[model samples]
Target chain A: MVKKLPALVGLAVLLVLPQVLGAEYSWLVLLLNRALIFAIMAIGLNLLTGFAGQISIGHAAFMAVGAFTSYGLGKFVGIPFWGALPIAGLAAGLVGYALGFPALRLSGHYLAIATLGFGVAVPQVLNLWESLTGGWTGVKPAAPYLLGISFREDRPFYYLILIALFIMAGLAVNLIKSRTGRAFIALRDSEVAAQAMGISLTKYKTQAFALSAFYAGIGGSLYAHMINYISPHDFGSGISMELFTIICLGGLASVNGSIVGAIFMSFLPKLTERISLVIQKSGAFEHSHFLQNVFKNFNQVLTGIILILVVLYLPMGLVDLWRKTKNLFTAKGVK
Target chain B: MAILELKGVTVRFGGLVAVNALDLSVEQGSIHGLIGPNGAGKSTVFNVLSRYYDPAEGTATFEGKDLLGAQPHDVINRGIARTFQNVELFKGLSVMDNLMVGQHHNFRYGLLPALLSRILPSVKREEAEKRAKALEVLEFLGIAAYKDAFPAFLPYGIQKRVEFARALVSQPKLILLDEPAAGMNEQETHDLAQLIRIMRDKYKTTVLLVEHDMSLVMSICEHITVMEFGRKIADGTPAEVQNNPAVIKAYLGEEEEAANA
Candidate 1:
């Protein structure tokens, strides 16, 4: 009961967020929705890279596959968003399972390079396959409606994304705590020992890829419907890099860390914009065009520095920092 | 009847022969020991049984099943489990989770069941049963206190015991323990010898271990196989192997050299 308090309070806050900030700060809700979507992807990627010890810098390729699949199913097959979402996930999972074949034979930077190829290849393929993907023009999915309730509104859409994130997160948590999750960690730590214990390397490695992509696909479906627009530009290799950064920043192998990292990443651009606005208002760089140009790209520089610092000082990530702080406070009270 | 039999098993790496036409047979429901000096290919033999190493020539069978034809992971499913000489406990998992992984074959459910485990009664029941079994093994091995602790945090001796607990949780018909007493002190080794016997009795399992600890081996093993330079030097009961001329020469060098000195 005591352990449930924090989660209950968090749920309450998520439920009241849109109502509190819907009319005045509607954009914040939208940004939070995007963060929730990325959180879903981050959780999935963490299972593959963090728990299973498989690297994938091409995760955005799975998202691209999901987005287009969902779009196509809605446009041609006449399936609604809810009906098409699982199918999109399955389609992406199939691609991930195919990618797992290369992963079986590769590891470390070689695997990264293989996945990077997939990431770079996907958008180009989407662009060239004009008949299905609509090429450069992209696709617009219909607003998702369930029963009589329309989720086209930003507030309702935020709730919808939040609900999806909740379910996905629950499922991921269950997986990590089960026998399958133990096999993944076992293989990561010691392949010889894992095999000795009856865990099939081929089975679990591919399963991790397929499951991770399933989450990414669902997140992509949500992303497609939320924005109502997607193209090759939306799921570029850059997005893949961003998703990788989110897992590292959050803390590898931790579900909470993924969510924390996603929230931080989603708001980072806004954070930089606010800082630049304040500096400009203060007239600090009025005569220096060089500094102004630097400020315009400040977020990129900040991201690089933060990543380097996190790698060096807090290798376990922001979740580790939170744990350390909590420990400090508890220790002081006990003393 | 022999629970495990290895006939004409030869393993070579380039010009080097690790196990040279080795023949070994362990009686059913007995504690067997394989001992030799460093690089005597004792571990290589264990690896062969574990299916980690494919022999150049031989037939290795467990209860009449072709062990060599099976995959490494399938060895566990075929009622065999092993511990590593280096103690290959999963560093990322807790002690309990480590034991749970040992029962991987017992879980038998697919990804869908695992995902829906939170809602499904069957999955939940299986998980609980596995957990209870793991805890029982931990208690039996006297490491129940460390069940929640990660492998990295435990002492070397405790980690080794955790490995034993892991192998035992599977309730396998045969267990291959590679240097199970390597890192233990004298007292822990004594306790381990007693534990091994009790475990075999309690679980009705057969154990074939490779060890350098002679006192522990001679005291507990019902039968012994001695190897040198990848060839069997002697095979008998403890007293018989202890007095065998070849076994003595292999351990303490030639009688002529000692007489001259």
Candidate 2:
């Protein structure tokens, strides 16, 4: 009941959003749609870091694979956007599975560096292979198909994206409660220890990658649909770092933490721009060097500050805060 | 017939010799203990037997099957399981989840059924039965009470017991326990000794022990092997090994105590 009450309240908010804030905040809803796709990326990254203990700084590369694969399928094969989505995810998953081979031999920081290499290399492939990906211009959406129902408006696309996010979240919840999920956690906890317990390293490590890539690919696919166009610029190292920030601030190993992390990190830039505008109105400070710098690079500075503060103050992430608060109330006046 | 055999097992790391042509055997349904001084290769031998370390020169035959060049998982799948001296428990996993991972070898579902269970709500899966069996093993181990508790949060004794359960979950033909009684006080050691015997009598698991705990080793082991400088110095029934001169010198160090003492 305790858990359900909060979920019900959240559901109520989702149910009321289209009515209360839908008309005025259509752009806000669109931004949230972007956050949902990245939320999937954050959740996928969690499988690697939280469950497998494999630090991958190249997650955006996998997302890029998803995005580009979707585009490739549409352009060459004339597959509809929805038709290419799962196929694109599967292609990215195969790439993730192949990445797992190196993981069997290397570990810790070395694994991170190797994956970072993979991340750095993926965008270059997309750019150099301009025959398919159209060089820097990238590709735009060619409408969407769903069981013969065509989507031609922002409202249908928004609701469609919201459903995808919910489904992916549900999938994550299911996986975290299963055997492979536990194995991933066990592997992350200690590889030698996990092996002694009969958890095979190659199997679980590959599984983590395949799963993480799957979500990222699907997230990327859905994200391409919503954004209407994508290029190498969107799914670059910076975006990958943002995904990392989401997982780290949410908590490395918790399912719930991924969503919370996504919510906060996603809104941060918009919030910073709002602050920058406020600072702009106060013309008295425009000539000062510090104010000028803040105006120019306020988003990056705010993002860096938020990340450092979250790491310092809540290393366990927002999940721990929720747990602490719940404990406070549950144990109130008891002892 | 001897169920497990090690013929001329030698492990070399560049110039240094970790194990020098060690040879021994543990018969079916017998408790065998391998003991030595701190630097001796008793644990090294165990690692070689479990295929964690490739021997520089040796062939290990278990139940007439070749063990050389076998991967670690292959060794376990071939009915050999082992616990580490340092208690290698999956620290992030709960006591129950750890045991489930141990049962991974026998669970036959491939990636298709595995993913199917995740995607569709209405799909009936063979995955449930595998999870059910894992729970049964935990229930059998009496630490089922710690089912939801992570190994990191458990006490040393409980963690030790969890490792034991993990090793035994596969129902291996031979179980190699490295210092199973290490870091335990009297009561826990006593319980471990009793539990070791119970495991053999109940599960019919052939036992190979590597330990520094003399009292527990002497009590639970039927046959014992002593090693020093990577070679077997002595081997016999515990009664016979107790009086061996080489065993005394290697363990007691120029002292006069019997090997079995």
Candidate 3:
């Protein structure tokens, strides 16, 4: 029971966040909701890249596929939003399974290039396929309502995403503890050893891809409903890079790291924008337009520096940092 | 009766024959050793038997079933497990988890079943049982104290023993030990020979070992096969092989010269 204290505290904070913050700024809830949804996707991607030792730069394509599939199923096909999400996940999982084929034959940079091709190709295909994807304009999904409760409000939707995040995160944790999860780690550590131990490489590699895609798909489905708007632009390579950055920041192979990464990604941009505004108003760069221009893009530069520093120093990520911190505090007899 | 038989197994690497036509048999319930010079292809024979390499020409039968029909991954399920020349324990996983991985074939549960194990009683029971069996093997191998430790933190000898415990957990009908006493001191090597004997006598498991340590091989192995340049130079009881002129000229003579020096 004591082991669950931190989780309970975290849950309490999540439950009270909107109530406490909604009175002052309502938009923060929406941002937090988006972050939670991305957390699910990050958890899934970490399983593929961190645990399974598969490199993919095209994860955003899976999200795009999920968004589009859920949009079509929920809007055109008349399936309810609740049902459409899973169907979208299924669609993305199938494609991911197909992508796993190339993974079997190629690895490292070769596999990354192959997946990058998929990422680059997806938005183009979506833009050209106007009949289904609405071309460049994209589509707006209808607001979801379940069991007489309208999720149109930000708070309700925030709760929905929180619930989804917890469930998906729990499932990922459970998976990492099971036999199949062991197979993934074994394969990652040593392929020859894994195969000699009765783990089928073809089966588990593809399954990891499919499972990760399934998570990304659910995330995309939730994203489509949350913002009520999505286009190819929303899930381009930039989003993929952002997801990768989140995993790196949160720590690889850590489910908790995925959540922390999503939170960092969600808030860091806003924090930078505020800093940029302060710098612009300070008039410190008034003497030179070049310095002013540099100040304007300072946030990007800072984020890049932070990423570099983290890679150099905290290679294991924020999760490792958190563990060390907890260890230090607990050693002080906090319990 | 022979538990494993390799007939006319030929493996070629481009222009070079890594393992020439080799015929060998490991009788059930015995400790057998394969000893050879550095390039004698002792490891290649293991690769062929484990289905890691498809022989250019040969047939391997385990328990009278065609081994070539099985894939590399399927070999473990067919009652065979092997340790690598270079230790291949998962670096990040604990010792206990490594041993548990050996019992992977014991649990027939798939992904869906594993996920639903929380709700399914039988699957949950299977998981607990596998864990119990893994712990039992750890105890049997006397590595229970290191169960929670990672492989990188353990001593080299302990790491090797953990690998043995891992193979033993699966309860394979035949276990292959590749260079088991490669990096051990005299005392550790003697202990390993004793453990190998114990595994055969107490556990009733067949061991097919490849060792460069002649003392351990002569002391423990009931039968020994000597190979030179990928072909069988001598195969017989340890006494006969020790006396064979071909074996002496190919392998033992160099050892004897080094000893004298």
Candidate 4:
């Protein structure tokens, strides 16, 4: 119970955040909702690449499938957003399962390349199927409704996203602690040893892909509903790269790392904007258009530098850094 | 009765024949040893039994069931477990979790059940039982204290013991131990010999081990097979194998004609 206090408090803070922000800071609420969606995707991707040790560079394709499937179901079939969410997730899961067949034979950089190909190809496919997807023009999904309430406003929708994130993250934690999760880690450590212990690679690999994709799909559905509009470009290779970056920067194989990483990623651009504003106000580089351009793209440069530093020094990720610091303080106290 | 049989088993890696027309049998409830110089195909034979390598021409069976037809992962389910030539404990997992993975076959729950384990009573019960079983094995091996520690941080001897504990947790009928005493000190080797016997007596497990440590092998193995260049040169009791001229020649190299003079 003592160990769970921080998590409980964090959840409490999340619950009351929108109310605290009030109506004037509604934009921040929208940003937080986006962070929640990314958190959901990060959790799923972490399960695959972190615990299962299967690399997927095409995760956004799963998200795209979920987004488009939900949109199509809602607009043409007249299905409600809530009903389309699960179906969209399943559609993405099927695609992930199909992708797992190639994954079974590939590993390391080879798998990364295969997934990269997938990430690049999905948006093209979306663009080609113009009649169904509206091509490059994209589609605006209707606001979600349930019972008597319309989740059209950012505030109410934030709660919906939070609830979804809670359920998915909880399930991810459950899976990670179970036998299936052990099998994944087993195979990751040594295929020969894992197989000798009766862990079927074909079974677990495909299962990981399918499950990871399912989570990505749910996240995508939430993203589409929250943003109100999405095009193929929204789920492009860049988004896939960003999702990959989130896991690496946050920590691999850690659920908390995924959430923390997603939140950090969501707030990074805003943080950079604040930094640029401070610089401009100082009048140090007001006349330098070159410096202004550099600050404009500062988030990407910072993300790249942090990713390299993390990989070189903190391979276990930001979560491991937290653990190390706590251990350090405790050790000093004992001394 | 022969618990495992390899009839005319042969494994070839391109031009080199690893195990050539090797016929060997291990009896039920016996401590069997396979020993030879490096590259004599002792590990190859173990690999064949584990289904890591397919024999170009051979029929391998476990308790009269076709072993060769089974997949690598299926071998454990068919009551055969093995340790690697090098300790292959899952480094990222805790010692207890490594042993839990060894009991993968015992957990019958699927993905959905595992996901809902918190709410499902049956899943929770199964998890508890498996954890208890893992703890029991760890205690039996005297490594229960390190259950929560990762294998990478443990000493070499302890890591090997953890590997043994992992294989034993599955409760396999036949446990193939490849070079179990490879890097052990004299005292650890002695303890390992005792442990092998204990495993057989306590669990009714048949043991097949490959080792370069002659004293430990001669003391523990009830039956021995000596191979040279993938051919079985000698097979008998430890004393008989020690006396065989061919086995002596294989180990000592041809008695030099000049030395004989």
Best by DockQ: 4
Residue-wise C-alpha lDDT for candidate 1, range A39-110, written one tens digit per residue = 999999999999999999999999988888998999999999989999999999999998898789998999
Question: Which residue runs of candidate 1 sit more than 4 Å off their true CA positions?
Answer: A22-24, A285-296, B254-261
DockQ of each: 0.82, 0.44, 0.69, 0.88
Interface RMSD of each: 0.8, 2.4, 1.3, 0.8
The 0-to-1 C-alpha lDDT of every candidate, in the order given, reads 0.90, 0.79, 0.88, 0.90
DockQ of 1: 0.82
Which residue pairs show backbone clashes in model 3?
A: none
lDDT of 2 at B149: 91
Better of 1 and 3 by lDDT: 1
Error (Å) of candidate 4 at residue A305 is: 4.0
**Residue-level error in angstroms, candidate 1, position B200:** 1.9
Candidate 2 residue A113 C-alpha distance from true site, Å: 2.1
In terms of lDDT, the poorest run of 10 residues in model 4 chain A is A298-307
Clash pairs, candidate 1, are none
Error of 2 at B226 (Å): 0.2
Arranged by DockQ with the best first, the candidates are 4, 1, 3, 2
What's the C-alpha lDDT at position B157 in model 2? 92
lDDT tens per residue, model 3, B75-156? 9999999998989998867898887788877778898865555657877788789888888888877889998999999999
Of candidate 3 chain A, the 10-residue stretch with the lowest lDDT total is: A1-10
Instruction: List TM-score (chain A only) for every prediction.
Output: 0.94, 0.91, 0.94, 0.94
